[model samples]
Target: MIISAIALSLLLFAAGAPAECLGEWSPHVVWHVAKIGKLTSELQLGPNGLLYALCGNKLIAVDENGNKLWESDLPDGSKSGCPVFDARGSIFIPGNALIQEVKLNGSKGWSFKVYQGSSKAAALLTTGPGNLLYMQLPTGLYAVDTAGHYKWMITQWDQVYNASTQLETDWEILASVGNDQAVFVIIGKKKEGYTLMAFGEGGKIRWRYSLGEIKQANLVVGGNGRVYATVNPKRTDDYYKGTVYAFESDGDGSPLWSYAMGCVDLTAPTPSEDGLLYFCADEKLYALNQDDGTEAWYEPLPKAISRPSVDENNMRYYLGTEDKRLLALNTEGRLDWNLTLDGKVSMRPMVGPDGYLYVVTEAGSIYKIKDEAPESDGG
Candidate 1:
């Protein structure tokens, strides 16, 4: 099932343009605290209105007021992308050897071993429809139900067409649940390039699309049913050339449009309320037409761009830089304000329910900042 209308509305609004531009903007730090261990992944807002931070081998839960709720250790090292919250309010952390479930009260629920062999690295974990949890292992993808029962497992060996060539398959980097409840994964083949595959409920392959020689891939599902992927050049010396591909959500895997970029977009494409796709790359923020893949506008940043996050009201877009700065941009692609952090920010800033932006630095510091302007006055 899709998210609730209220939640979807908020997401669309945040991704979309604001109703109007702001006159002046200022942000002030409300609170700052040091985490227990080095943050391993981005901060995820839980269903209980608490923020969960993966720090080394531990999971730390903190409130909006910067109070620590609870801290617990996972079964194994958690190098997975991020922990996801299921519909039942439980957090699932995919570790190297096992998948650990934690209840909202900071208690362990259950643990399931993903693989029996010595290698136990899980690259990605995401929630799909039917209350199912999807995981990406080195061998392939596995699906588990809410009760922690293994539904089905699909490996690269099962999907390869030619057995004699012995093509090597790379680890899955991106996985997302589409609007139709199908699971989408991007995998790399040694000589044949990259393949985007959609899997049905019973571990069946719905469709697969191939793109040649993709060095970096970032995927995002739009507010509409379109799937957007940014593929960078494979050669490290030439990172400026890239392409953005849009796929239909109906499982046919047909391309809607492909837009070539002047620079490689290392970040995922974000959809705005106005149906434009936004991404940061090479010290600039680019807005593209979602339907036709045409350039709408581009805004230059003071430093190389990092990941970006949109506010709930679609009023501002928050982004970080390699130069230790957090920036807020209005819908018109103009800079609203910016603040320098203690260290460089590699991750996107997360907007909390308490009307504050939670930013994490590379030095393991977390800061909660609030806008000095009033919300009603469009600051």
Candidate 2:
């Protein structure tokens, strides 16, 4: 998918007005992180610090300095999927009924149709395990090659297709659930009503769980082989409850533990190397023990929470919040330091490979915050 690069420097220069207004706030924002394009989904920083965003029907890739490298547009009328980079620098996008492969140079390689037009973003998963696995629209799971060719498609849940049941796969397993049956029990409002299905490597049904009507986000597989998810349900006359649930990663589908909170959405779980999974729920951030789902520590913030970023040394966690604050917290969940911004933080604060914290706001502002050396008193 190699394509010749055409210079759009003039267009970029013209669109640079938003970047200029970034620091209407401070001298603290040392660098103006440019918004190369409007992102429909959250932007992910590659290991090389390159920024990748899923903007509407296009995939935009930019350098660390925010220089646009390439932008690949999707087919008109086709739903957009999240951008995921495979090992070969190829991009995998599952949209509508098709899984498309994109080259690093912003060219289309090939595509495989996994579903008709029922594919949902929640059904797709990407991870490293010597193989690439993906979920099909409607109800199926498949693994394909770097070239967009299908390896296998699992139809074990074909019988549940008429029931609106959903399926997902991650790390190296698959899970499915029908709309009517009980798979896993969800105790409260936040804990209730979502169907989960788990499968093993060979397309075997490993486990099934039911959540009673709660919206689950950041479903991830932990190191100990447990599936962790954040649950949030719509507000009702009853008190709203938000929770994180951990299930046995192996196909047994048993519950490990659940933590409750107020109305909040948890960004995907950020599991630390020390066996702790970090999550942001409601206005609080928590680090929990993955083994039995016990709270190791938690930090209540001045505002609603955003996704967290771990420091280079893993000793600190960085998060932005609705109250327009950027904070760094120590491992103990104590505030290490914090800075205030003029605008709200709806985007996840990105910690670039260069050690700079990149933040963007709904007001179209981008700021790069870095640690300044301690000031010394004049002798």
Highest-TM-score candidate: 1
State the local distance difference test value for candidate 1: 0.72
lDDT per model, in order? 0.72, 0.57
- Candidate 2 to native Cα RMSD, angstroms: 7.2
Model 2 TM-score? 0.74
lDDT of 1 by residue, 3-83 (tens): 111322111111111222234766767667654356888888888888788987788887766666677877777876678
lDDT of 2 at 203: 51
RMSD of each predicted structure: 7.5, 7.2
Error of 2 at 134 (Å): 0.5
Clashing pairs in 1: 15-272, 15-273, 16-272, 16-273, 96-120
Model 2 alpha-carbon drift over 4 Å, by segment: 1-30, 47-49, 76-81, 114-130, 155-192, 235-240, 262-264, 312-314, 340-343, 364-366, 373-379
User: Residues 1-379, candidate 2, lDDT per residue (tens digit)?
Assistant: 2233333441222121121112212114544544444555566766455666676577766665545667778653134335667667777765655667767667888876654333343334443223554544434556666766667666434334435444431111222221111122122123324556654554555566665565544565555555677766565236557777887655466577887766657776776667788878767888888877788887787685777777645456777778666777765677766666656676667766666667766544456666433351211
lDDT of 2 at 248: 66
